[model samples]
Target: MSDRSATAVVLGGSVAGMLTARALASVGVRVTLVERDALPEGPEPRKGLPQARHVHQLWSGGAQAMEELLPGVTTRLREAGAHRLPITTDMVGLSPRGWYRRWTESHFMLLCSRDLLDATIRAQVLADPRIELVERAEVLGLDGTGSAVTGVLLRAHDDTRRTLRAELVVDATGRGSRTPHWLAELGLPGPEVREVDSGVAYASRIYRAPEAARDGFPVVNIQPAPRTGGPGRGGVLLPIEDGRWLVTLFGTRGGEPAATTADFDSYAREQLRHPILADLIGQAEPLTEVAFTRTTANRRHLYERMSAWPENFVVLGDALAAFNPIYGHGMSVAAQAAVALRESVEEFGWGTPGLARRLQKAVARPARAAWDLAIGMDVFYPGATEKGPTRAERLVAAYVDRLTYTATGNGRVARAVTDVMSLERGAGVLLTPSMLLAAAVGPLKPALGGPPLTGDELKRAGLQ
Candidate 1:
């Protein structure tokens, strides 16, 4: 109740945390971002964020949001050697039924090392005069009740914990967030939780792209065929900054990829739906040792859906839900959710009662979209979860399969899919009467016989 303006504490230094700080900081709120680890000085490796070892993308939809939150960030990334890859046009992927031909470009993506992404956003967020970062500061819990959270307690570098009073606290600590436990401590029950894990394991390594493909290589992806009655296996070659290609090979329970050098190339050649990745990488130089994780899962904490929730607190990003990273929607969803946070705060006054609840609920709209898109195929892959898809899941999967098949030949259908995936539009837009009619009418063009690589592209890739 001091005369000074209210303060906010953001827990965790993940992408979500930085973006949350951006939203609040932009609104002139004083923010203290608490991180337990020493952030890297540049776009380099950090021990705490192991997921940085995988393929990461900022989809056009998410890129737009990030741009709005931190102006000129895209330019900064590109100047730092990050490639802005146009979708469909710059990507070659093997869909479930067949190879997906490159359609007319509808969206673009930002490809770079996750380290670069984190560093770039961290710099912009911290640049805000209203925000401050406290390294090696770990959050303990909250100070107020179930209806309204007041502040957060911090454990400094010396392990001495002190209360930092605030009018608000945002939980962006990502998948490992203790928000649920914190809520329980305030006498509020933990929210409903749901998890569907396909027992997916990820293995990623950096490759020095060939001189020809260094600056302009297409993003090559061989997506898993979930309907093939076995564990899903997939691979991607992402062109990142500094002449590097971040290649990741992953598989579900019965068909997992390995982390060791002994097993990496074999899985690259034998397991994936296509041999193109292995063929391409055969001549490339390996830059980093393979890194592995079995932590890919769809976990959701339904905090907003709770009948009673606290004010002055909202959980965004991976704290609210963490989708399977293979989908590459995590960063986009985080960006869009951050947009919702900005919108909600503006719609309602910053300190208004129920502002947190409204923002939390709004953020879930994007989370639900990401979750549905992820679990749609994941639930069908063998050993992806404890059980198979529900009856409703099967129906939805059938429809999506038809749509994917249609999209291979129909540009409009492809655009509709991109519209939703880009986070520019909702999935409901796809279910409109016109889209349903288009789906029923079938594709206007024939399915492509092979990938859409041109003669020049082939020559450039050294395939000629």
Candidate 2:
């Protein structure tokens, strides 16, 4: 660890911010985490995190990164009731191409409510003496010029305002970040932004699983066929902690799910391409009202592409790029970016002249991978962008569509696809010569006739 006595002020105390604080503290940086709301002491809901009610899973790619940042945290999450689910193996999904065969596990995901995931990480991060929590404090703005940010201007709940100085400042605030305005106030040029809005609305609810099917239940997903040119509708039933299933139903623009209890079951039963999710939830009992959100736009602020960046400042997580939650890449990308943040700081030393810029560029790698995966499909939605997907995006989507079809009948191809989907590998893996040849030959085996649920599973869920 460097003995430079580096200090950092990380804005926002969500998953990204907490992971970032933990990362910096690992390198001996004293970190102050600023949050707009008081964090909960346990795995309970907190204000301002409406998305916590929705389905959240930490992919193995991210789980590994989180483990590196906070050792033994994964075991803690498991101890707290988070489910360790192996991908493809623990998944019963109907893809646009066909039903995906449940192959041997290539990766895994940690399933639980967002609240539990956040609280678990928060507990571990706060236990470190190097990090301090500044709750119920609002960040007014940066306190320096375009060339450098020396501190943050903060307002307490009592309306008292003061500037807190630090050698480094990181913005881990989510999609609602005001970094663009903050940068402009510092006389910096605004970063270019790209947004692809599918106009997708989400309605999620929790269900107490049927006693016999509560544990070891597979995650069921009904993916929409976006190429059909109709309003895409999809649903996912994730078996979370406490023997509960978190189900989220979503539809693009015209076919959006209603935020009412009465319409929830109907949409799941009839609107999606498959009714497996509905069938699974049919034997369960509702535990919570529908939590709805329309903030699923794919937005990216190209801070790395900016001609100039302020020193001692960096941005990470959703502040850099926010994806449609349906893809489940946001949290994984944030975890990967936090790892990048730490590695970059270590490589260049915390106070290096261009360290902040290097960090910004480094974090963008994982964000770009996830952005491509999300927008590749979302851009096909009607009115997603003023101009439809670019020629490149269309071409890539076509190839990916073929790859998905091949994956359904090819275990090797499925592993490669999941490698990228789990954020464990890059999209370039799909373009390898072997992969291309495999896609060309198409599925080596026949497509699955239906979801590969065992007889016992069917009986347990009362779907037999």
Candidate 3:
């Protein structure tokens, strides 16, 4: 281990990297965040993240983690046009089980442009004097071996070779991370890998909100059913800041949506299970052109379960696990993972033996929960079930479908489902005796035939 214990090389500049660096900085570790692309000065796009062109949601679980790491982060995000949408209550959703009643807010989600969200978190992390960034720097490999990683080898993003080293290394490089290659180079056995590709594609566009319906707008969602043995199609119309609505429509494989504005309206109106989202956007003016991305996949690298992991090396964020964007769990899970890292570091103190291993294992605990949720549904896609869903998968999916169906009317079941959706509680919470009984009993109240929007909401949106 390096004697100074002052500097750590953080590979990546996205939310996960920034948050990880922020966590390290809080513990007195001077961090250098390496980014191959130049970060935007404001809420703008960066080359590294193509998904930024799409709408993103920050779940309450993630929001809570971010708030803990950086005080007033949610406030900052909201001040920048991000909307904190309450769960179930604020969401009009149709699940595989049935139409979810617009019950009271069980949880909440922050809706906004990916660029603005990144910029907000980036600015806060960069403001910390101890956390510095090395733009145009690319991580090459590890400096040490299986026993313990001494540092990282980095080069100018443009340089073909030559690298700079640090005392400790963190891989927060997102879904495309090369940690596996680096580990092989160090002679360490590669960790197990798990993936469930939903064959999901996302098409998103920004809309100028009408003069009226700006504040207190609800989120509209229609989920696809995997059990139907047909393509899953989903849509969302969310209220962001600056009088804008970020609408994203997505489908699996054959049902993939288009990015063209013309198709945006048509798809929403014709393709989706509900007409609410399409209707909402019909009244709003088109802002930016539509953006399309099909790279959304459910993948996870089991670094924590590695038989022989090097010390002084850790992974966080998408680099460790990535989920389908449709679920909107990525950011929140990243924040939660960063918190695990922070707590682990605090427990062991800096440079303690087995600290990195302990943190990796601890962080993976929540990661396992999230990965299970994403792949559980994703693996049911047509091509997704190529390998076939396990017996456990079918069982769990059935129970979840029942739970979602129950939540449509039963507030208790709705709360239980929301607790997991918000990620406020673990999956085990749903398996509780009360939840099982509730599921068996069915919804206690009658289900709504349509969205639970009040007459006032319709008036605000200029609904005919």
Supply the global lDDT for candidate 3: 0.84
Lowest lDDT 10-residue stretch of candidate 2? 1-10
**Of 1 and 2, which scores higher on TM-score?**
2
Please provide, for model 1 over 1-464, each residue's C-alpha lDDT reduced to its tens digit, 9 standing for 90 to 100: 22467689888888888998888877767899888898888887876878889989988989999999999999999998899988788888888867776877889999999998888998888888888889988888988988888888888889998988887788888888998899999999889998888888999999888788788788898888888788889999999999998999999889999789868899988888778888777878999899998887899999888988988888889988998998899999998888888788778877777788888898898899898888888888876667778899999888888888888878888889888887778789789888888888777787777667778767766777
* lDDT by residue for model 2 (215-271), tens: 999999999887777788999999998999999999997889999998999999888
Flag the better candidate by TM-score, 2 or 3.
Answer: 2
Question: Could you tell me the TM-score of candidate 1?
Answer: 0.97
TM-scores of the candidates are 0.97, 0.99, 0.96
Best to worst by TM-score, what's the order? 2, 1, 3
Which parts of model 3 are misplaced by more than 4 Å?
1-5, 157-163
For residues 1-464, could you state the per-residue lDDT of candidate 3 as single tens digits?
23566778888999888998998888888888889888889988898688887767888888899999999988998888788887877887777767777777778888888888989999999999998888887777888877988877767856766555566688989989999999999898888888788789999888887777888888777788877777899887878888888888999978899878889889999998888888888888888888899888888888988889888899878888888988888888888988998898888777788888898987787788788888878888888756769999898999988888888779888888888878899998999899999999988787777776778888888785
User: Which one wins on TM-score?
Assistant: 2
lDDT of the candidates, in the order given: 0.86, 0.92, 0.84
